[model samples]
Target chain A: MDNLKTKHFTFQLKDLEISVELIEELARIDDSMPEYSRFLKEEIDSTLSLSQIEGGYTILPAQLDQNTIHIGDHCFNVGKSIANKFTNSTHIAIFTCTTGPLISDRLKELNSQGLILEAYLIDLLGSVMVEKAMDKLQAIIEAECTSKGVNITNRYSPGYMNWDVKEQKDLFAFLPENFCGIKLNESCLMTPVKSVSGFIGIGEKVRFIKHACQSCNSTNCLYRNSKNHC
Target chain B: MEKLFEQLAYCIEFGKINKQSPYPPNMKDQEGAGELTGQLLDQGVSADDILQKALIVGMERVGVKFRENKVFVPQVLMSAKAMDAAMIQLKPHFANNPGSQKGTFIIGTVEGDLHDIGKNLVSMMVEGNGYEVIDLGTNVKAEVFIEAAEKNPKAVIGLSALLTTTMNNMEKITIAIKKHNKNTTVCVGGAPVNQEFCERIGADNYSPDPQGTVEFLNRTVA
Candidate 1:
């Protein structure tokens, strides 16, 4: 089950079908935004067309030695946070997802016009959209691994665990460039800015915790308290 | 007629662009900020009064509401658009009557950060509060801030950064601004910044939200 590569798979949930209800819930809208329901729906429809969802993953066999996880001849010196996460995992799935550049252009236009709130809402939507795509990708991966008698653990990203964000370059090396029309800059930040890149663990009888938000420093995140993960 | 200013303020607060705008459902087809400001000015109301009374007052209400989380981002954007509509009506008056300036506010997102939502929010709120805002835009270098301060000595410089990595540049910008002119006030804010970081970086002030920034300007820069 190690080094399994599942590339070029499409999404099940129609990208636009990601409920506006979920976006609203994530944005924490209340009664104060008069007529915002209609406004958000319009923006979502416009922004959804602008979004280009792309995701892919390749499985790699890993050998965890104390705190370091060696996969496909590359070693990750993850800290205690991630080391404990992959404890029962036998394989690792490296993944990346993005909503492409359109959302970013929309955000820029909103900001330049001093439409702060509109920009902020769209930014939240971008996160939700990317996550929505990732959720579908995860579901497919789960189904694939399930038939193989392997259990997949929760997904993990750098900048959370002691896994340094500098390691983002490492993940990009294995995936095809423009794998999802996403690219990394010198700073390791994915272009289009609304992209997500991370890894998931696969194992048998492994316990998976969706997210350890309580331990995360980003308390202001909209999704921090929702969906049992950050 | 006296209530024209009040009506203008209400229009601005509710994001009424014009009688044609269908927003704020209840206010549909009613006079909006644009129409109200034009009518008030034509009726001989002073631009200063309209600006200081209606536009500023309206933004203050929204700012307070935003601080209380009573209004979210979309609500604020509508209000800002309404304010812009009103500003268009009064732009000519203010252009010729520059004495109505409250003070200058030069703002930008710190270098290495492309994020500007917070910076733009503060810019609109501050502008609505009556400052002659000179927005430097995002990824602004410390030198640009200092240069702008040199050009407008009375200006209070605002530095914004949404990323933790870029937040570090706040200290450098603050130090540069202070070194160039120690009396020039430097305000900082964003998700990753706090009052402690502000003090550690030698910034003069820090606010968690845009309204607090306006209130800070009111108490200090005003």
Candidate 2:
């Protein structure tokens, strides 16, 4: 039964709108010949698949006694390792807030076309990965709250509906190594192409509702926000 | 007649484009939608009869398959491409009759989102369903959408975003459009977007796939 459940949990790579041009560019970045375009096409032809088990999930496995929780040993240890690799590490700060950096230069690019590249499917893939990772983390955190007999609120992250992006630093500070394998570049991006760090509020006042993309202030939200709720 | 329609629908369902266009591995050098459609036209079939009876019938099946994940993007893209090939030959008749299209649809990726594969797929599907789609390209701002909506009052608006960061921008634009014209129906989509986001932002509709979007537009216009 458990084996069947695990197999059922396997998720196909959800559609990440990829352009023919970007596939070509990715091929170039790999230093493959232009004929490699055919290879890229073939890969695109074959949809990408990812699973929750591959994403990895862990329970908080403990309880928080206070509303204002600080980055303690385990989370700090993980975050510290992440911070060390980032440039301009001194200015990198962490906080506990709802809003974080939702948009950044890390998402946009400049090219010879004189037009800024507005979005990338790779970025979308990363966003989807982060969202699924967050879901796994939420499962763990929620379980912790339930085991402790506390009603938790929504998993709020920086750059949420009304939350400001500036609070990303605070969220980073709370996590271990700013997230195990994820790093914040000078421009404030979590690397590894697949990672997320956010906090789930544990209280009675936390709004529990279906995630709605239209309700959020971030209209152009790409990560699994309210967009997936419906 | 039903047998002929079935073959044409099969050609479209499996993405058989013509006698020469090779794809799908199984249907090499087979008669595609193009030839079948042409043959139907030469048989004194009304343009509307062929479109409604044959082309749209197959596409609706394709749409349902796409929605159920029975097919993926590449297959759908191929189907859309094949649909376009057939439409090219049918377009002249539509040119003769201006009322052929159900309505106009304006689509784009909201500002901060450069992704267009979703928008393009929707455009192709909507076009396949015989609606004229004015693709505004990507990274479009609220004002651009408002302007386009004002210009094409009959057209449905579609906004797409492929990044979580840009999802916020989709909301802002949706709000801005409603503020300008409350009646404008904005359809929100993308991999991350769902119906929940649509209601939250006050958009009229949300679709997980191109087929749903077409159905929404069809129901609205119907």
Candidate 3:
């Protein structure tokens, strides 16, 4: 029974260099805002610290419920809206990428001292850095899995498409303890405020689907119009 | 004197905080909003004119950019910071005389939602636009919002929630505010909130961005 196992991945800071463009995108600045670039560069050089952690699971044969999927000795009531995405999927990968606690702590300090704007901006940069780290992680997975002749789908996280946030505990259980020093509190929020957790689907025919913002129930998300990011 | 106000407005619009700030490369080492405000006051520009003519103009411009997605969080933040530094000098003037502020605003992220990024941005934008923003910080309960509104009877209350779960509390808070006093204008916004959610909760309105919130509040008191 223990032979059914999960693969883990960790990344070094230097291996993940968050690009200026990504930070700018996260900041939501479409124009060439020179000042934002200046501040972001300073933040990346001084305040930013990235740690990437990911875990993958090869699905075990199991049946699906109207709102639940039984796979690999675990069952997730992933809701009908999200289960629709998994119809043709064979395996699912769960991962978390964080900018570590350093940036989050610093943001709080900035906020308390009345540096609300600067703090909020840096917080956006942290999110972008974490996203870049995830990209690198996905690349590593794709390189290894390509030889296996399997296709990977875009990542989906909880709190979207009726996949309740409480299901985060089920997702985390498949990974190593305190994987990359990330933890979920009572609120299902990751310890590092900039951290993200999500699942990716793999199948022979699954290609990356363009995120359909309209299809998503959360119609008012700021990032919905810029759907490529998710 | 007019030139000084113009300079102050420009400094704030571009997020030139002070002479010491090195962010906006074009304005590096130049007198920013902070220094220009002090100089304008020293030259006898009234606090009301400085706020109405300089700071409000800058904030309104940034607000429009934010709504259009031309300026992101960082740019708005820089402008907010410059506005804050300038406000440090103007606070004393308003303290000595009443009615200097256009209105009072109380804002917070709803309970169980630790996210404050959105709330902070709105608070800064509202404050920059000549309102007195009382930020209750993140994870605020309905009672806290109600109490604050009670203390400042005419204050406009804003509730923010980034989490879908926490958005439920916004509805509760709005009902409590209306119950406490029907006239209080309670506005709501966040990633999970929309116009439908806003109206369902009986809130006065909803804004997608900070500038939109400022515009809504401006119209309410105008």
Write one digit per residue (lDDT tens) for candidate 1, span B1-222.
Answer: 658878888887878888888878888679899888888888898888899888999999999998986776667778888999988877788899887868889999988777766788899899898888999987789899998999998999999987666666788889988998899999999987999999898888899999999999999877
- Model 1, residue A134: what's the lDDT? 86
Please identify model 2 stretches exceeding 4 Å from their true place: A1-230
Candidate number with greatest lDDT: 1
User: Considering only chain A, what is the TM-score of each predicted structure?
Assistant: 0.88, 0.46, 0.80
Tell me the lDDT of model 1 at B197.
94
Candidate 3 displacement at residue A186 in angstroms: 5.0
Per-structure clash totals for the candidates? 4, 53, 0
Q: What is the alpha-carbon lDDT for the whole of candidate 2?
A: 0.59
- Top candidate (TM-score): 1
**Candidate 1 ranges beyond 4 A from true positions:** A1-16, A24-51, A62-85, A108-122, A161-179, A212-217, A224-230
lDDT of model 2 at residue B51? Answer: 73
Deviation from native of the Cα of residue B86 in model 1, angstroms: 1.2
How far does residue B212 in candidate 2 sit from its true spot (Å)?
A: 1.7
Greater TM-score among 1 and 2 belongs to 1
Identify the superior model by TM-score, candidate 2 or candidate 3: 3
How should the candidates be ordered by TM-score, best one leading? 1, 3, 2
Tens digits of per-residue lDDT for model 3, A1-230: 33445555665555567666665665566553445677766666655544333334333444556777676677888789677666666777666676677777778888778766567667666666667677876776666668789877777788878888878877777666677678886657787777778777777766677677668887545455342545
